[model samples]
Target chain A: MNILEVDRVSKQYSGHKALDNVSLSVPEGSVYGLLGPNGAGKTTLIRIINHITAPDSGSVTFDGHALTEADMPHIGYLPEERGLYKKMTVGEQAVFFARLKGLSRSEATVRLREWFDRFGISDWWGRKVEELSKGMAQKVQFIVTVLHRPKLLIFDEPFSGFDPINANLLRDEILRLRDEGSTIIFSTHNMSSVEEICDHITLINRSRNILSGRVDELRSRWADGHYSITFSDADPVTLMEALAPMAGSFSTSADTRGRHTLDLRLLPGATLRDVIARANEASTIHAVNEAVASMNDIFISAVKANGGDTPAPVIS
Target chain B: MSKVSIIIGREYAERVKKKSFIFTTILMPLFMLALMAVPALIVAMGGTETRTVTVVDPDGVVAPQLVDTDNVKFVIATAGTDTVAASADDDATLLFIPQGIVEGDKPLRLVTGKAASMMLENEISSQIERIVEGERMKLYDIDVKSIMAAVESNLSVNTVRTDRDTVGSSTMSYALGFILTFLLYMMLLLYGQMVMTSIIEEKNNRVLEVIVSSVKPTRLMLGKIAGIGLVAVTQIVIWGVLIVGLSAAVMPALLPADVAADITAMNSGAGTLAQSNLDTDLLSALALIADPMYILGIFGILLLFLIGGFLLYAAIYAAIGSAVDNIQDASQLQTVAVLPIILGIVFGMMAATDPVSNISVWTSIIPFTSPMVMMSRIPYGIPTWQIVTSLVVLYATFAACVWVAAKIYRVGIFMYGKKPTFKELIRWARYK
Candidate 1:
């Protein structure tokens, strides 16, 4: 069910390997987060997939066909470095871009009007792009990106210039696009949103794909098999005291909320069932859940493990 | 519409609505009309300055012939000062005629507050010459008509082509050629800079990235180029219609009949081309224009070369635009394109006087200069092979230049902030 697949793609530019042996498969009807630190070659892979630049080696298949110029109409890409013709009116520029993406004149106008009204920017139809504020202009560009309603939508740093309210609005729209069966690929440093919306992700670092999988799988893969237990039995210390015997082999902490958490290092024979069974002997187990890492933690840890030279971008 | 066509339409439609385009389209023709009409108006209105000359005829022989003219009035002074004063009582000239003037020992003297203009001096001298000649004739009793009829002979050279066609006036040919050549040159500068600046502006504005991702780079550049070319052509046609309309109808109406006749005489031949004989020069120029082949050939070559030359230069201009981050970075390479067009203009102007010179012959055939130089030569009747060769060279150069430029432009649009050098552009062109 992959809508787009880029495999073993390598691209070189003036002695720099912009993308090297990168592979990614975006599932249909899912939001795919393309994650990377600065200069991680995410944009390069996006460009290759979009056919903006050709890969030195490897191939990209879109909707079961090799990506080609003919496929451009089916792929909508909103580049990170994007702008509109400033002298052109907002609606005029939007319609022109939609037309470039293979929309008919009447079709482009109709579709663009829908998007403009949805974004509450119908009044900006006759206003030039220069007259719009930065966020307003970005809204115009975002509408343009999705106006053609291609099967595969790619957005690079789409939320960079939007306020939280508009960002959430765009986030809702992006999820809606996914729900409607359009595959989405967007690259950003915002991990919380990535976790919030993305079902799958491909993490690229240092011109290579470091890790990629379903978001839940990736977050759990980076997780330590530790559990935080909250029990309201006769005492929560009973749970801590139960782990006190294996204190030399495990770590334990008790929060003020009578929740006991234990960091367990697995022995060859030890299992989560054993730990739970041991805890049950001392107290009634109210809740037992394994701790999982957030996407931000996984991103930083994965980048750190792979080459680890690049500074981890601060999550805002 | 196809993507390229859509892009072309957008490029054309968006700019055509701009205030700058409308202002230029309307203003340039007016400027051209003013250029052609202002001088003619001044000459027509300059007829009202009249001056009076007082003649002090100490000698009786000079009094009877003193006459008035349109701009000069002569008042015969029966009694006058013995000496001509350094300054006149008014701005008019005062002449003191002494007895020595009838003899060969004295010169006719004129006195005025302001120094005499050569024009006034010539008029006064001619008046004196007429009087002196009359006096001399009366003294010798010789009739002036017999002298002119006896010795003056009219002779003219009529050049007929081997095909039994009469050659037109060389001056008129030069004027027409120079004007057409200048028009080509100006069109190149105007349209060439427009294409270049438009590209740079798009690049700087970063709008190129979105458009290029959707449209092919070559189509985008060509679309923009063609769009601006259409605008340029629209402007030129409008100006052409306006200027031609003004020259053919309005100018004649505004001018006095005699002055208009003078202009027509001057435009044609036989009125005052330093060889006036039955207006043959003017007639031939008019005839050359009237000849279908002449009209077809001049415009044919002009159209061919205009497209060829502009395409060739626009490729270079677009490349220069792409090679930089903005107009400031483009300044250095801009001179490279402009200097050649200028050299072509110089060769075009030089070709009018010395069409057969090595410079004209070479520049007329070179692609960069061919549009202007060949335009000048075509009006003067160039050889068929030369025009064909220049056209071929121009078209070939245009194809090659666009090919190279498209390569650079594709790479340039993706680039940011770097001020690329010529060598870098060459390398970019070399890249896949």
Candidate 2:
């Protein structure tokens, strides 16, 4: 069952359309990824869902009912801009926010403490929010957001300020939430994080959804049947010469271990087996790995194909 | 938690805990004490030394009658090269009584270091005239007995008013009325701004979003107002108790023996006045507040006016906070809100000088300005109808402001990035 359905929602600001007939859905118990570059209307859509702003057209349905003001308490929204009263203590702010989300004081405190302990931040409860580091503040925000356990959770760039370890911890928690039957709509530009956590992805460009599908399906659909080969004593000239006829493009570089390696992007209808055979004919193939396009690659290709210039991908 | 209570509690706690609250609450009384004691101390240090005025009576008629007193020593100088300026420099005020031939044409000149104060000059002139009149009566061989009889035969009239209450007035009543009106006005303004500024700060910091999501906007706004209002009330109660308590505890120790005697004498005089003019029930009521019923009356009127006026202005402040996204924007609106309060205070001060005057009546009737004006008039004995009408209007204005404020609040809290002008706020009020 679909927990949330945003159908052809459009929001205009003066002459500029922030969200142009953008439609998306989150199935029950799924982690949905909203993928877009900067200023691609993801925040606008999230804000619309949160009822901070109204859509210029179309409607949103929650749990098979049309969205209304009453539905606000049932949805938890973690806005991109993290705001907390600097002078208020962590526990106070958390409980205050939780209560707004419909939790009683005792209930909010209990849930907040449990989350605080889980996040290893029980010591921070008495400290002012301004005294916390960005990641610590984000942890408090996360606890507040989930304290009431809303059926649907919307997070916009939730992992932006988290360290890698904390980021992984948040990822695990998000997955756990999904497993516990919470539908999640997360908007982020971190395609790798999306690739790891998102079950479904939507790529919005120029205020419109240009491509969206299951993450794996989208990756597969954008795959070019490429394979990378690594071998000791591999001569780049010989490998290139043997694969020239079948290879659409190829680059050779030495790996960190000083082993010779070759990367190839095959032409359309080319098979991974055909590249492997060509590489095997020239060099002693120590490793033959089929290269599947990462979400980053698919995102770039989708964006590029939809008339957006794909910048050089940065690998971390 | 109930929304309003929670809001009120938060507002109460947050404001009372602030350092500013603690500072003001403690400092105000100390300042007031210094204000009251400084003049009396200066006078005491100056001492009761008399200045000798040598009157050069060339006519020789008025000299013997002008007797010396502790406040002013009169010396009769008989034309022995009188250095008028030198004598004035030594003491001050050398009166020169010219040789007067006629009874009605007596003239005198005075010399002093700097110019003699108007009060001193008037005193000297009156003394000279009394002396000259006595001499003229003696020159006509009019016996003192016959003069006394003739003066006694002249009609002595008593004044009575039918429409006005004959409470008779005092300097203390006027002072009390001014103080009560001023204190209430200051507290309302000082604390109302505090509430408004706190809301604006929270909104600017974006913390209001979190708070508003949990508590309804109305609840949160009211809670803050109530919380701060409670804090203000607490401070006032403490100050009142402290002032009365401290004064009672320290006043006897601070007063000199002579001053205390004078105060006792004054109290006896007041007792006689009270016995003659005030009814027994009114006297008992006056005794309850240490025989300052006018002070208590002014205080009661001030309390009503303060609460009504503060709530009315506070509602406007809350509306301003909601309508504007930042403190800067709210500041622009603050001018308009403060104008009426300022006008009330200024006019109230002026009304204190003449509480029964026409201007005071008009000021007390206008709802916006009435709190201060009515408080000032209470000591001068306002009509019961006027107080009732002022209260009714103030309460109605407060309710209307709250209603309008709620509308602005609902719309304004969600608005960001842009500030609406006065015209825009009017439009927002009319928004469907």
Candidate 3:
């Protein structure tokens, strides 16, 4: 079941359309990836969902009801631009955010202490935000974001400022939060991380959702009809001679250790069997594999194909 | 707590916990005390200054009855410009009553070695006039009755107001009005700017987005301005109570015993000052100042106007803070908020001098300057309709400012980089 739904939302600024008829459905207890390039209206859509800015036309439903101010407590939003009061102590800010999310003071303190202890940042409670490094401040914001135990957590570039170790820790916590029944909507430029964790994907380009589906489905949908063949005793000339009749294109290269590999794209009527049989006529085949598109490749191609004016800001 | 209250708490706590706030709260009262005490101390020491004057009577007219007091002594010198010049070396002021003195020419030449003192000069002149009067009374022999008849019977008024509460010094009223107007004026400027700085700080740090996401923008603005206002109010009230209390305690110790007794007698309403032989201006000023009712009345006015004036202006200050990306960039916009407050102060100063004049009446009834102008006029007992009209106008203006400011603030706080023009801010009010 989808926990949050944005329906036909459109928003316009003074001279620009920030979002145009955009829609998305975030399922319960699953990680959903919101993909977009720079100025493709991702931030604007996220802001609308958070109710920081209302959509000029459209409705947002949470769980089964129209979203309202009272529903804010059930939704945790960590904006792409992270900030905290510089002069405020970490603990006080934590409790204050919790209270703003409708937690009682005692409940906030207890939960905050547990989160701080779990993150090994209990020492930061007394430190002012300006005294902390950017990574440490991001951690505080992360803790504040999830401390309310929200049902729907929208994190925009949550891993921007973390070291690998801390990144892994946060990744683990995000997965754990999902496992414990919170639906997550994650937006990032790190395509690898999205591949690792995101189950569902929606790609937006030029203020429109161009492609969306399961992560695996998107990868397969964008895959080129090519196969990578690893073989023994296969010379480039022999393979070219034997496969040129059925193959549309081919490339061959030898590694420094003298292992030869051949790449081939089949003609429209050709099958894997035809390529494999032709390859066998030339040399002993050790292995044959089809090349599936990576998320990064799919993202670039989809954006290019849709004619995006500028590239998305890629973090990794 | 409501979300607005949480924001209010955060805003208030951040400021009150600052070292500057702590130091200002403690140091400002001490500064006021120093200002009040230093002058009173000087007046208490006034009796000890001494001077000597040499009288040179060329006509043999003024020597016999020129008696001297302990602080101001006199010595008779033989008549001449040369003798006066010789005595001048000792720094004794030389007072020359020439033979042609009755003609009012060569006009009572007094010479001294240093810069002249008006008090010492006036003392010598009055003594010479007395001595000359005695000599003339004997020469004329029938002149005492005629001299008495020649004196003009000037009439002076001792006014008692219809309220039967006679704290009777116009200077004291003007002084109290000036003090109260200045205090409210300062609180509004200081606290309104504080709200502006606080807004700009949050904007600069990029924390305003996080805050606005949690609470509505209007609520956030309200909490911020009202919270900082409460802190200013608390500080001013504490200062007022401290000054009043400290003055009550320390003033007696600072003043001489009989002066203290006279002040207490006036405070206690024991005797009408007009009936006393001591007809000094200082005693009347003291009587007016020491009236607890008058002081209390001023205290009440300050409290009323400080909050009202501060909120009236702080709303616009917050809006100005939000309309720009940086504090320095916010300055041009700040002038819009600052002008009315400065006008109010200057108007109050002008209007206190003539509360019943048309300009005072007009300015005091207008909401922008009324917080200050009305307070200045209040001590002079403003008419009820003027006070009511001013309050209604000001309250309405303040409400309207909050409404307009909130509209600008809601959208402006999230805007980055560009410095918005006044027209753009107005447009933002209508934007989604």
Candidate 4:
């Protein structure tokens, strides 16, 4: 079941449309990626879901009912532009936000301490936020965001300030939260991370949702008719010669271990089994796989197809 | 706890723990006292060094009558002694009296190594004039003591209100009114700005979005106002306790033994000491101050006006704080909150002198100025109905203002990049 459903939502600012007829569903217990370029109405959609700002012409449903103020406690949000009060103690600020999310003071303290311990930041509880490094502050913000055990959590650009190890740690925590029956809305410009963790995604561009679907399904649907095969102890010339008669284009490269990799783009109506049979006659086949596009390629191509500008893909 | 209370608790605790808050709470009263007392203390402590006036009285008539004062001494010099030709290092002033008949002809010249202060010059000239006048009076046979006695008069005016049988001191009323009114003015401006600064701080911290997601922006705004308002009230309450406690402990030691005894006796037997030989004005002023009922009355009124006035202005300040991106941008919108507070003080001063004036009555009734204007009038014995009406209007207006301000705040906090104008603020209030 969809935990959050935004139907035909639209938001207008003073002189511009922030979100235009944007709609997406966040299924329960799933890691949903809200992807978009800068100023692509992603924040506006998240805000509508959180009820930070009302939609000009749509309704948001949480669980099975229309979202209301009472439902706020059930949702947690870590906005892209987020911070803790610098003068406030770390432990105190976490408890304050937890209480704001409807946790009792003692409950907040107990839960916040557990979360702090889990994050290996128990020693920083007494320190002021200003005294913390950017990575430490990001950890505190993340801990507070999920400390209340909210059913639905929204995180915008959660990994921007973290190093690789910490970002991986955060990504693991988000997946863990999802596995524990929480619906998560992860909004970010980092497509690689989205490909790594997101179960489903909605891509927004130019104030409208341009593409959205299950991550694997979208990748499969956007796949070109390309395949790659690895041959063990095979000569590069033989690998290329093996595919030369297959009525298709072929490229060969050899690894340091002397195993040759041949990339093949089959012409229409060419069967994969036939290609494998042909290659088997000349060389031992180790593996065979279809070439699926990455989310990065899908994102750029989709945005460009919708008349949006993206930097030219660099070839290496 | 409720969201607003949680927010209030944080806001209050965060500021109350600040060193600046504690320092201001303790030092504000001392600072005010210093402002009033420093000049008087400087004047009371006059020049400490004594200077000698070298008297060249050729005829020896003026020298006999010249007397030494605490800070000035007369040193007689013989004729033909040019004191003016003394070394430049000499600090003494030369008082050269020409040898002439009783009829005035030549003036008395005073020469100093350096330029003499106007105070010292006037002192010397006045002293000589008095001496010469006494000499001239001898020729007329006028008794100096009787003439001096007839010229000095001790007059004290007591104010009696025809509306009531009470005879109150106008001076006490004015002093109390102005002091309390000025205090309200300061608190209104100081705490109002505090509310704005904290809001801007939260916005800059980028924490508003995180907190507002869980709580309604209206609740958050009210929570902030209530929290900061509680801080203001806490400071004032601390000050009140300190003032009352310190005066109770220290006033007796500072007062003269007899006056303190008279006060104690007056407390024990009111009419008995009233018939005794203590100054009625001092006794009444002290009695009014020591009256628990009166202090409670003023304190209660001051707190009511303070809360109402603070809520009214703080709502406007909060809206302004949210509308702007930074403090520099806030200055322009701050005039909306500042001008009304300034007008409150202006009307308060007018009320201090004439409590029943039309402008005073209206300003006291208006919510924007009522906190200060009504406080200034309360000490002057304003009607009970006027106080009730003013308080009702002040609180009602506060409710309306917070409602409107909450609307603006809800939109303004989410707005970034552009600083909003007043028209935009009003338009934001119209948003659903």
Candidate 5:
């Protein structure tokens, strides 16, 4: 079921379109990834969904109802620019924010304690926000965003300040929230995190949606259908000559330790078995593995295919 | 149930809990006591008996009648040319009564260290006159005591006026007026800034966004103004209570009995003056408080003006806070908000010089200035109709300010990055 629908929302600042005819929907109980390069209008879309700025022309629907000012209470938004009162204590600030989100003081206190203890920062209750580290403050903000258990949660660059360990911890909590039936919309440049947690993805470029699908579907769509084959005693000259006509595409190189390895790029409508059968005919294959495209490769390919002039990979 | 109440509660709780509040609450009364006590202590320590002055009569013919008394210690210096310098440093006024003078023509000269005091001069002059009269009486063979007693004293002058009622000195009126105006002006300024700073802090921290999501902008705005206003009111009340309670408790013991009685008489006299001008006294038309009605009236009008004026100005402050992304940007707009308050204070203070003058009337009637001006005039006496008109205009002005402020608020709160100018604010007001 569609929990949020942003239809053709356009925003222009002095004739420069920040968002142009951008339309997307998030399925219920799904971790939707909004993927974009820098300045791809991802933040603009998020701001529109958060009702921070009105679209020039578009309508938003939440839970099958037209969105109104009253719907703000049911949606939690954590902006990329983290804001917390520096002079206020963590506990006081949390309760104040929670109360604004419609939690009573007592309820906020109870929930805040649980979240604080779960995050292992219960001792930070009395500390001012400025006194906390970047990651610690982010943790507090994350807890605040989710404290009231909003039906829809929007997190922008949620893990930007976290170390790997804390990043993994937050990632787990985000997945847990998705599992518990909360629709999540997250926008990030982190392809790895998107690969790890996102179920469905939408890529926006230049104020427009360029590509969107289930993460696996997008990966599969961009897959080259190639396989990597390694053989103990395979001669590269013989293998290349034997498979040259039927290889579709093939390249042989030595591994780091100088062992024989062959990489093949398959043509469209070709199968990995065709290349494997040709390589096996030349020599006995020790190992054969079909390559699956990672989110990074797919992202780069998508960005590149859309006339993006990024630099090729450079070896360090 | 109202959002304003919630805001008020929050503001009261957060502000009253601060250490500064408690500290100021206790410190002010002690400071006031010290101000009153130190002067009295100095005066008491300085009081002493009057100093004595001696007169030396040099002429031997008239020296037999030189009466020495406790207040006047007289020593006769013989009539000689060498005795003048010796008597100059003797802490005495040397009176040289010329020898061989007629009974009625006894001439005298006075000598002292530097200059004799007026008291010493007068005493010496009177004593010389008495000697001359005594000589005249001896020549006529009449009793000198009866002749001296028959001299008439200077006539006294009394004044009576019929055109105007006697009022207290303009100094007291001006003092009360200045004080009342300043108190209102300062409280408004202090709390208005407090409101602005609080809003800016909240906005900077992004807490305002969260708060506004649940509460309407109007409610939130009203709540903030109300909350900070309550805090201001609480502080003022605490200060007032401390001053009044402390004075009532310590004034009797602190002041001398005669001085205290005089002060009480002055207070009662001022009250009677206020009563004498009943038609002009604004307090007489209003419900009288148990305390001095004029003071109560002044305070009541002050509260109304402050609450109304603060709400009006604070809303603008909140709008300014919302419009700017940083404190530096807010400072530029602060001048716009602070200028009217400064004008009110300056003009209101001016009212103290001439409470019944035309300038005071104009200022008191002006809504932008009436809060301070009318407060200043309350001590002297203001007409009921003028008070009502001032209040009506002030309330109307407050409402108008709030409307304009809310317009700015709606646009400014969400605005970031761009600093808006006056033109832009007007444009934003017209945005939808």
Candidate 6:
């Protein structure tokens, strides 16, 4: 089930359109990735979903109904630029956010204490935010973001400042939240992490959604019809000559042990069996594997293929 | 609890718990007490010293009539006493009336060991001049007593308002009006800037987005202003209770019993100050201060204007703060909010001088200047309808300002990096 759907959302600032007819759906119990280069309107779309800003045109549906003020508590957002009142203590700041999310003071206090203990940050609870290390503050903000257990959680650039250990911790928590049936909209430029956790993604560029789908589906959809093959006791010349007519392109290289590997793309109407049958006539096959595109390659090629002329949205 | 109240609670608690708030609350009354007590202390310490003036009149014409005061003693010098020697005493001054000085061109010569004070000079010169003039009048065979009576009969105007039970001095009213106006002006500026600074801090901290996502920007902005306002009111109330209580305990101790009774009688509108032997100006001032209704009226007008004026200006200030990334960038935008407050003070001064004049009346009725202008006029007993009209306009304008400010603030807080111009702020306000 789709927990949130944005349809034809459009937002215009003074000089430019931040989002142009951008649309996406966040499915329940899945981690949805919002992929875009900086200034590609990912943040704008996130803001619109958070209701921090209104879309110039379009509608947002949350949990089977049009978005309203009452729906705010059901959504949690941690913006890219994390901040807390410097003079406020960590526990007080967290509880304040909880109260703002409609928790009673006692409930907030109890939940905050549990969260603080779980995060191993109870010792830092009474310390002011200004006194906390950057990583520590980010952890506190993370706790504040998920403390209410909102049905939908949006995290923008969630790993920008984390060290490897903490980043892994954050990733684990995010996946855990999804496992518990909370839909998540995660926006970031880190494609590897997206591949690791994101089930679905929408790539936005030039204020428009250029590409979107399930991560595995997109990888397969953009895959070239190429296979990497290794042969033993095979003559490179004979193998190339036999596969040349059936293959679109072919290359061969030898390692230090003098074992040669052949990489080739099949021509139209040629099947894997036909190519393998033809290659077997010339050599003994050792191993054969198909090559699929990584998300990084897809992202670069998709943005570049679209002309890449979209100047970054003026943030101010 | 409502979200706004939660915000308000945090805003208030954070500020009230600060050391600065506590210091300002306790120390402001002490500061004011020091200011009030310094002059009285100086007067009490300096009142006892008496100086003798030796009069060396060659003709002995003006020497007999020169009288002594509590601080100045007039002593007729013996004939053949050296004027310079007689003036050698540290506390004595020698006055020489030349022979035939009543009819001659020689000015009265005063010789003192040190330079005499202006007050002593005026006393001796005036005494000699009066006697000299009387001698001249006798030379003309004129009726000096009848002329003196005629001059003394010149009328002194005593203003009595038909609505007021006792006669009040216009100068006192102007002074009181000016004081109240100045207080409101200061509070509006101070508290309004406070609102702006707090907004800028939240914006700079980048916490505004997190909070705004939970509640409407309007509610957050208003909650902050209200919370700080409660802090301001708390400070004022503490200062008020301290000052009023101190003055109540101190006033009777400072005044003679009879004079205190007269002030109490005048406070009740029973004793006429015109019949008192005391300085009527001082007595009336005391009486006015003693009147509970008058002080309450002043306080009521003050608090009303303070809150109204603060909300009006603070709204604009909040908008300005949200439009910029930092306080440095806010400086230029703040002028728009500051200019009207400054203009209000100018209008207030005008109202103090002439509350009934067209400029004062119009400015007091206009919302932009009414908080200041109306505060200055209220002490002079302006028409009830004008007060109602002014207050209504002030609050209505405040509501409108908050509405527009919230619109601008809602958009401006999300914008980063560039400082928006006023035109941009207006555009932001127009965004749906």
Q: All candidates' lDDT scores?
A: 0.77, 0.74, 0.81, 0.83, 0.72, 0.84
Residue-level lDDT of model 1, residues B276-322, one tens digit each, is 33354444543343334444456656667777888889889998888
Candidate 5, DockQ score (0 to 1): 0.31
**Clash count in backbone of candidate 2:** 4
In model 1, the runs with Cα more than 4 Å from the true position are A227-289, B33-46, B59-70, B79-122, B125-164, B251-300
lDDT of 1 at A78: 84
Give the C-alpha interface root-mean-square deviation per candidate: 1.2, 3.1, 1.3, 1.0, 3.2, 1.0
User: How would you encode candidate 6's per-residue C-alpha lDDT over B1-432 as one tens digit per residue?
Assistant: 899899899999998999998998898877875665443344334465678888887788889978898668988888555755544667467888888877865787887877688888888878778888888888999867578977875333457778866675676678778987888888888989999998988988889867877888888999998998888777777777776666567755666677778888777777476677665555666666555557766776778878888888989999998888888999999998889889999999998999999999999988888989988898888788998888899999999999999999999888889888878988999997
Predicted candidate 4 versus true structure: per-residue lDDT over A238-283, tens digit per residue? 6676666663667777788767788788777777888888888878
TM-score of every candidate's chain A: 0.86, 0.89, 0.92, 0.85, 0.91, 0.89
Prediction RMSDs, each to the true structure: 5.5, 7.6, 4.7, 5.9, 8.6, 4.4
Cα lDDT of model 5 by residue, B60-139, tens digit: 55566766543466665543646555645566455665665444465456666556667666766677677777776778
TM-score to true structure, per model: 0.84, 0.70, 0.86, 0.82, 0.74, 0.87
Give the top-scoring candidate (DockQ): 6
Worst 10 residues of 5 chain B by lDDT: B281-290
Off by over 4 Å in 3: A230-267, A279-287, A312-315, B33-45, B49-70, B74-159, B252-271, B277-281
Give the TM-score of chain A in candidate 3.
0.92
lDDT winner between candidates 2 and 3: 3
User: Candidate 3 clashing pairs?
Assistant: none
True-vs-predicted CA distance for residue B335, candidate 5, Å: 1.8
Model 5, A1-316: lDDT tens per residue? 8999989888876436888888888999999999888878888788677766668898899989988876876888877766777777999889877877777889999999999999999999999888998889889989999998988998888888788899889989988888878899989878888888888999887788878889988776765566777875667878777666655467777776646778766666656677777777777787887767877777777778887755232111
Compare candidates 2 and 6 on lDDT and give the better one. 6
Note the B-chain TM-score for every model.
0.77, 0.67, 0.79, 0.79, 0.67, 0.88
lDDT of 3 by residue, B275-322 (tens): 544433466555554455666666776776677778889988988988
Judged by lDDT relative to the true structure, which candidate is superior, 3 or 4?
4
Ranking by lDDT: 6, 4, 3, 1, 2, 5
Ranking by DockQ: 6, 4, 1, 3, 5, 2
